[model samples]
Target: MPELLNSRVETCFQQAEAFFNRPFKRAQVSLKLRGQKAGVAHLHENLLRFNPQLYRENREDFLKQTVAHEVAHLVAHQLFGDSIAPHGEEWQLIMRGVYELPPLRCHNYAVKRRSVTRYIYRCPCDGSDFAFSAQRHGLVHQGRRYLCRRCRHTLVFSGETRVE
Candidate 1:
């Protein structure tokens, strides 16, 4: 599986190199990624991380789409620099023109999410409750305010918390 993934990544890089008319260094692939993300491209480090579980479950799609998707990120960064958006026109162009693949922003794999504690916040408009993760909850503690999109009102803690 690893060898196949490596080969696919190399093939993508070769396509990118030929299309962009520049040498692209081979990117390091790691299967250390967990959770929902199928893969991530660390542009600055020229590294790609793939979720082993997701890859094993969806091997063909992961190879054909996900590999090209991530490689496009690196190729786009190298050709257009960091000023361009991560999934901007440059990336879409590479996916369509170079690899002839769709420029999909995310994978649709069914991933199991680990249960975590959630902090509940409420919107003033209609008392709709919103659950926030620990990271966002901490950000709120540090005086960061989040607004409710529908109501256009600031979120306030409802003194509720849950673990599920």
Candidate 2:
């Protein structure tokens, strides 16, 4: 894990402890490529399965948001048994009171964004342009070829460009 992520996790843990009025035992945190969109939480097993891509991709806001979401789940389970509603009013209150986060909302993890340039492409037909931060977009249906949905044209991958 990155140093920044480690710090965020620690901060989240402290915040959760303060809200719960109890000390939280050490727990494991790891980054995953994809996780269930339901919410972030402490997983007893398969810690790496917890997707950090959300936080890694959107470092600024997501790091805190995801940490808060997972911390809420841990706190809820600790206070109330699993019988309580996963997303009940109590959870919402904890999210705000403990983590100082807004109400829960849907998160779209599939949205692609550009950070540093790993690859560049241009649409052959309409001259549209696209850039990818990662080596691959993970869309392998057509063997690394991406067709422009709008123009229905093949995208030609150009060599990497240095982005500063």
Off by over 4 Å in 2: 35-39, 42-49, 109-164
Among all candidates shown, the one with the greatest lDDT: 1
Q: Model 1, residue 51: displacement in angstroms?
A: 0.6
lDDT of 1 by residue, 1-164 (tens): 48999999999999988887889988889999998899999999999999999999999999999999999999898888989999999999999999999899999998988889999999999999899999999999999999999977899999999999
Best candidate per TM-score, number?
1
Clashes of 2: 2
Q: What is the C-alpha RMSD of each candidate to the true structure, in Å?
A: 5.9, 8.2
Across residues 58-157, which tens digit of lDDT does each residue of candidate 2 receive? Answer: 6776666766676666666667766777678777888888888885756655655444655567787777668765555445334877789888777777
- Residue 137 CA displacement from its true place in model 2, Å: 24
Q: What is the C-alpha local distance difference test score of candidate 2?
A: 0.65
Q: TM-score for all predictions?
A: 0.70, 0.57
